[model samples]
Target: MDVSFLGGPHPQRGVGVVAPFDFALDRELWRWVPAEVSLHLTRTPFVPVEVSLDLARLVSEHETLGDAVRALNAVAPEVVAYACTSGSFVGGVAGEKAMREAMTRAGALPSLTTSGALLDALTELGARRIALVTPYTVSVTQSLEEYLAEAGITVTDRAFMGLTRHIWKVPYRDVADMARRAARGHADALFIS
Candidate 1:
């Protein structure tokens, strides 16, 4: 018998991520993927608009995301994903569909977004009431709650740090505390938005 194997990050599959210019959790995202999967990333232009309406407008732009998806397609990834939650959810369910359609049309591959994925996950878990946790301002976090409500998932409780800058600086212990607080209610599941 012959046995053959190689060591050190054998990337057998590639996933393209169309991300925001300010996305800072690259390491966290990579950690969730299997070692056999490689990530190809392209960033869309982002203006510094922290307000809910302005930020929604900035992220919901199909043209910007389409260009980014096309660029990622040059790498021939098996799938493309829009990694921004706010951008994906701001337009509601219909808008999310359009965003996915645009990405697929641009790259000729399967496409999804963070918000869409979240909805799928929640449904798969049969979670009816969710405790929300976020590092965004109250207004932005409330918008997320509203989006989830549109999907018929009730929010039992929520925690927000009201942060707009230096999100990377938040301590894990603090996050854990917030999570604990959010889980205090009678929620079926916890969602960190």
Candidate 2:
């Protein structure tokens, strides 16, 4: 019965995540996180609208992001991340930067948005051209494309589901099929959004 020699529990680092109210991929997010780091997640306030440019605007408002960041600050996360593709890209590159700035202003923590992270990943991979698959309307997909273009990346081929809601409900087989179609022609990378 001698268990006193065991070491103390490791202190967990925290990462704050601000997700859209409709986001259903919390488990997916956790899959990439390490055991030593904890994710403190908050959702934007619910808005009565389908997934669209307007909904993206509402969820990614500076005030909403500030409030979410303030809430997450209570947990003292080392960094904060906004976890919405359309919301972060709807306004393009400038919008994504503004969201990160707003979150930092609210919590004084390093901040990033999904769109910004995607751009960073592309740059890191030296991927100048990519094929894209999205479960969003044409307009939303166009916004994402514009955002990528602003970062000097090109979408050589693309496919979309034209969906305004229930994006998570899309079957994997369909997504794979779309990816296969989109990945046609030469591309440095394949992006599924």
The TM-scores, one per candidate, come to: 0.91, 0.95
Candidate 1's residue-wise lDDT over 99-144, tens digit each?
9998889888999999999999999999999998888887778778
Q: Per-residue lDDT of 84-181 in model 2, one digit per residue for the tens? A: 98999988888889999999999998999988899999989999999999999998899899889988999999999999889888899999999999
**Candidate No. with top lDDT:** 2
The residue pairs that clash in candidate 1, if any, are: none
Model 2 ranges off by over 4 Å: 1-8
Off by over 4 Å in 1: 1-11
Residue pairs clashing, model 2: none
lDDT of 1 at 180: 98
Q: Determine the C-alpha RMSD for candidate 2 after optimal superposition of all C-alphas.
A: 2.5
**Evaluated with TM-score, which candidate comes out highest?**
2
Q: What is the lDDT of candidate 1?
A: 0.85
